[model samples]
Target: MVIDDSSAMRLILGRIMRSLGFDVVEAPNGAEAIARLQSGAMPEIALVDWNMPVMDGLAFVNAVRREEKWRQITLMMVTTESEQSQIVRALAAGAHEYVIKPFTPDAIADKLALLGVLAY
Candidate 1:
């Protein structure tokens, strides 16, 4: 799933995931993502955005990490939060990878590959 407050961001990410042969799902915020999970949507990976309304990415990461059922979902932060401390915090909060905004599709693909969510 691509979880971002901006529909445009979700669209762009979804397109990239689709091109990589993924079936994409979208949520506008962390809360909605959780709701979808509760409704039984088990996405293999989630490309989450920080600095969202309702609930942010860190909180979502923590929430997902706390749940055993969600343990298999890879969490990747695809956001503009590029500070080293922020990256550390997101990783500590259970994000498997991080990608700053203004990134090329190749950058995203590279990270997803590193995370083992994509082949090649």
Candidate 2:
């Protein structure tokens, strides 16, 4: 799932995910993304944006980690959250991977590879 409030960002990330062989589900906010998950959307991996309306990514990460049924889903932070402290906080919140904004597909691919989520 691609969680971002910006339509352009969502479009870009959706394209990237599809290029990487994923059929993505999109949400404009963390709450909506969670709603989708509850509504039977089983995305193996979620590429989440940090800043959003309704609910932010950090809150979403904490929420996702709290759910036992969704534990199998890999959570990756894909956003402009470049601050070191913020990154640590996000990682400590159970995010599986992190990718900064303006990152190339290779960067995302590399992190996904490390997490064993990228298609072979």
Segments of candidate 2 deviating more than 4 angstroms:
none
Tens-digit per-residue lDDT, 24-118, candidate 2: 88999999999999998888999899999999999999999999999999999999989999999999999998999999878888898899987
Error of 2 at 70 (Å): 0.4
The most accurate candidate by lDDT is: 1
How many residue pairs collide in each prediction?
A: 0, 0
lDDT over C-alpha atoms for residue 39 of model 2:
93
Model 1, global lDDT = 0.95
lDDT of 1 by residue, 84-103 (tens): 99999999999999999999
List lDDT for all candidates, in order.
0.95, 0.92
Count of backbone collisions within predicted model 2? 0
Q: What ranges in model 1 sit over 4 Å off? A: none
